[model samples]
Target: MYFLTSTLNLSVIMFLASLSIPTSGLDCYSCSVCRQPFSKKTTDTMTGCTVCSISQTWVDGKRVTTTRGCDKSCSPADLRIKGNGLVKTCCKTDLCNGNTNLRWFKSVVLFSGLIVFKLTHI
Candidate 1:
């Protein structure tokens, strides 16, 4: 029982600790006219960014351009311009804004804890 309790405590501590770790900075891609989904062609790599962002401009309901870069502050929003549109996307992970599917980090940590717990019990 003591061993079980210790193991459970360790698992909880590990999960909590992972959640509290502070990132010194985030890395992101910086580019003008970045390709959709993701592109290998980035103009530069940005470090120490608070957020990563992608902006898309559409003309007559068709996407015409994409831009990717690091941002100090960003909020996802859409704006319309005379039947055209602009969309801005924001994410907290490295290079996350360039992709259509944002990667979730918390879920991975929880899954890892569950795996560790199962392996320890077995």
Candidate 2:
């Protein structure tokens, strides 16, 4: 009886532990698809596309830096533009920054859970 009880407790603990882990290992921010400070290339020149690159600088007593990039993947800009309608913008259509790997993992986990539940119930 003790062995059976211990096995059941262990199973429950393992199940709860699985839930604690984030099924989605997606870095939504700072991803190439999410932080896309530029537009998709249509031509060789990347015209009208904005480009942004972050760099750290030491200023006076503080370390400060600015996000610099092109206004439209081609045009220069000093700050991040809001709703500028640039092509290939990250996080515009998808919640994740084009993280296909994370998406796949999430889907697999969801489906697997459903299958397990169905099997147990039926």
Instruction: Give the winner by lDDT.
Output: 1
In model 1, where do residues sit more than 4 Å from their true spots? 1-22, 41-43, 81-83, 101-122
lDDT of 1 by residue, 40-71 (tens): 56457788888788787889887788888888
Model 2 C-alpha lDDT per residue in residues 18-97, reported as the tens digit of each score? 64343433222232222233332211121222222222233443323322222222321223244222222222111232
Q: Best candidate per TM-score, number?
A: 1
After superposition, candidate 2 runs with Cα above 4 Å error: 1-13, 21-33, 36-99, 115-122
Reference-based lDDT, residue 112, model 1: 56
Q: Candidate 1 lDDT (Cα, whole model)?
A: 0.69
- Report the CA-based lDDT of candidate 2 relative to the real structure: 0.34
